[model samples]
Target: MNPSAWPAPAAAVANTLLVNPTIASRASARFPLALLNLAAALDRNGASRIIDGNLDRGFIDTALDALAQTRFDALGISVMGGPQVAPAIALSRAVRERFPQLPIVWGGYFPTLYPDTALNADYVDYAIRGQGERTLPELIAALRGEGPPPAQIQGLSWKLDGAPVHNPDRDFSSDDAPPLLPYAKLGDPRRYLAPTFLGRRTAVHQAALGCRFRCTFCGVAAMFGGATALPAAQRLARELGYLKHGLGADSVQFFDHNFFDREADMIPLLEVMARLELPWWCYARADALLNLSPATWTLVRKSRLRMAYIGAESPNGAMLKEIRKGTRPDQTLEVAELCRRHGVIPELSFMVAPPHDTEAATEQTFEFIREIKRINPQSEIIVYIYTPLPEASRHRKDRGKRAAAPLLDLRGEPVVFPDTPEQWTQQRWVDYACHADAPWLSDDLRRRIRDFVTVLRCRYPTVQDLRSPRWAKRGLSAMAAWRYRLRRYDRPWELDLADRLVRLRRPQASGL
Candidate 1:
């Protein structure tokens, strides 16, 4: 709030608990606020100086070493983006090495993703799966011999006599969860890769968890056991207090699986929040948004609901049915119209070539995006390749020489299918840009979609005057599609089309 009075540079004081692994922090732009805020909570409850290792090169071992020079009585850790498991284990080892007597605690998404992997990590003395504001401090108190034993703590995990012990966990869906720490007051995103687009400017709020729908390709469902909404009005007010007061951020983003999933819980909270002035963004399922009439959506809009990420996975009913998206084509379209009426940009996050996708079916999806933009050129849509993932699909187990991970090759063809996986991923992201209305682009692909667009502008008006950029966009996208055609059994005809299309298109640019 001042030219000279900025927040002070953070320094290390005693009793600090090193937080989050920096290795896998690049997933989003928002770094380790959870640890910083938790430190605040601990300080609010009675603890001193919390340092975020997530934004620092402070790995677990680094934190453990830092602990050696100072006298921090208790240790705490937060995790996410399952990749940090290795570094966390290494940190645990250091904690054991440097402070065998100090108590250690761990929590976050990875533990949420794989408690067994987390529980098994030898370095982790204990793990707390969900919402640790209350549980973590109690564990510290117990360690300090100041409060109830570990068993009484709501979300506790520990090792006794070399065996993992989990206290009967408490259900947190009803819990208000420590108010979202002030986003403005937290550590940097160069730490953890959750969501950085809004960077430190936007507040990330949760309206609900446990997506009621069962979509296998989704990381949210697999990462969290299921969806559960936060409690109604009063509880919602309390959490908002954290975003408004603790963080001093006015702009907000709800990180719910479906912001409108429960009208009973949502309407009251929104009505209350409407009294406060702020811009907000949210994600939603198409059917639920459609359930809100044009008038209700208008109210949501008047309340500063600026944009929404809607799941319109496919244009085909069969594709939608196959993924069990639980919405009809008509319903998705209705929501699209409603979004425009409310003046909220609907960024349709679409899926193509899902396990059930066919080339014909995908073309129809392109048409669907075209229709939305045709009605309103401002209609933004984004598409993603429905690449198979190992997270939660029934196809999770592959006994063969697969590396237990899906390493995305944005440039190469997909080897798994040998015939077309590469082309499919490329198209999906292109379609996503079209779907999100952000800008259809795929820099990772060997074929340049943006360049393809530049070439198309010769026949088409630039995107500003784009008379349905989708169709012309299709012509350019087909260049990569043709490449996939060649890979289909390495046939001669497919090869000729790939060569011919590139050859034919290469010179037209010179005339333009």
Candidate 2:
């Protein structure tokens, strides 16, 4: 038979609806750009009629009623980190109950890492591992009887005869060149808020794929085949332009794990961002921030790089080494000071209650928090219990598994760390409150600490001010004054006392 006589390809048969379950945050939520990008990818490949839903926005009943009304061909739910797993499961179960005939497919890092576990669920009919930009459309086509069978679809998992089967991973490096996100499917871009920049009209985008550095606790590098690559700077620029003009977005947060794996690539991308003049923030390693040059700083200023969230993990040098964080405490300090000098707010994220934490190490972390506050009073510090990601080999111990289980939903709960006393764990939690200062605490000190805060709040009155960051600091300083006056406390001593007073109620209030 002649090739020219072959049959024409079939069009996309089923309309799709993608769901991004709530990350359990009420104050703010990010746009489901990953699912949107998947929709756009499907659209480019002749698959249209895509819609989106957030569990946080509408009742599950309403969402199901809408899906019932539309009769979508398939349901795509995105589950990235462990924190999103429980919500995704709930959404999947609800969708299955409402639309039993409709195919339910799970995607994103969680499913990618645990395909078998995802497929084993009673509600999940399929799972798309790694990247879904290509696999999803093919799966939809297959479901519609247009494309290959499930066995032939790469990067997909399905159960057969009560056993889960995973096909080969997709080579999706090219998929990093993101298509225009179908924000229209989401409706009312204004409703999507980014609170980091004071609730600006914001969207999330990715400039690079994968990370060059392989931190032992992370699985990104392994997931992407240890390849760190960048999309064309001009291409990224065009996508951002479309997001701005087409979707009314004024700010973007790069979802890249490490936006600057290569300095050369980053410089060109920063140059393009400078031309666009959109304020942005990204996650980067401490080393990357410390190495920024004067020219790069100028470009950063022009780009309005308002913040950098550095993955400092821990302030103790040994803990940093244990996690293979590839940077020292001094480098973290340097990066924090550097970002401050360049007028970019440095938000450092640390992990407490790691697998090997010692009481002494926890003490170093408490002191480290103070050093960061002193270096930049306006700096934002985020703390997490070291979560052993599902696929990582380093966190294979019994304790690691226990620690990882509770954090699967990204909720702030007390976690177990090996060889540490409960008092130390309690102390770490109190210090992580981000108050001006708190000393090491125990159960007996609770009442005294509360009384101290009550008295200080009465005198300082300004402690409740929220007009601006400066005002908050002024209020905090006034509260610190009490510790200085009565106890003859110096700066560090006053900060320690303030920390104790402000955070005393947390440990008892937030149960272990």
TM values, all candidates: 0.62, 0.74
lDDT against the true structure, per candidate, is 0.54, 0.62
Estimate candidate 1's alpha-carbon lDDT, on a 0 to 1 scale: 0.54
lDDT of 2 at 440: 29
Our tally of clashes for model 2 stands at 8
lDDT of 1 by residue, 1-512 (tens): 22122122223422447456554332233435457556756766565444454455555545655564556656676765323544555566677665566666778765543454466655566777666767777776776667898877876767778676767655545453554443434444222322222333466666566576656555555434354555567767777665566556666677677777755556776775676655777788777777775556656866787677787888888666655568888877777787777787676666654332234555577567657755654555554556433442221222132223343343443323211112223443323312321121233221332222232222222222222345544554454454332322222343345334433332111100
Query: Candidate 2 versus the native: TM-score?
Result: 0.74
Evaluated with lDDT, which candidate comes out highest? 2
Could you give candidate 2's per-residue lDDT for residues 1-512 as a string of tens digits?
22122122333345677777765444345566677778887776554443343424563555576575554567788875434555666677777765666678888776665676677778888988777888898898887788899899988989998788878778745643445566677666656644344225767777687776656567574466556778788788888888777767888888787886667768889988898888887878888867777888788889888777788888778667655678999998888788878898776777654434334554466568668867975566654445454333221221233232233121344443312112222434324322212232333333333444344332333211232355444555676665635643223444455545443222111110
User: Pick by TM-score: which candidate is best?
Assistant: 2
Q: Over all chains combined, what TM-score does candidate 1 have?
A: 0.62
Q: Give the poorly placed runs of model 2, Cα more than 4 Å off.
A: 1-12, 24-27, 48-52, 81-83, 176-179, 193-199, 390-473, 480-512
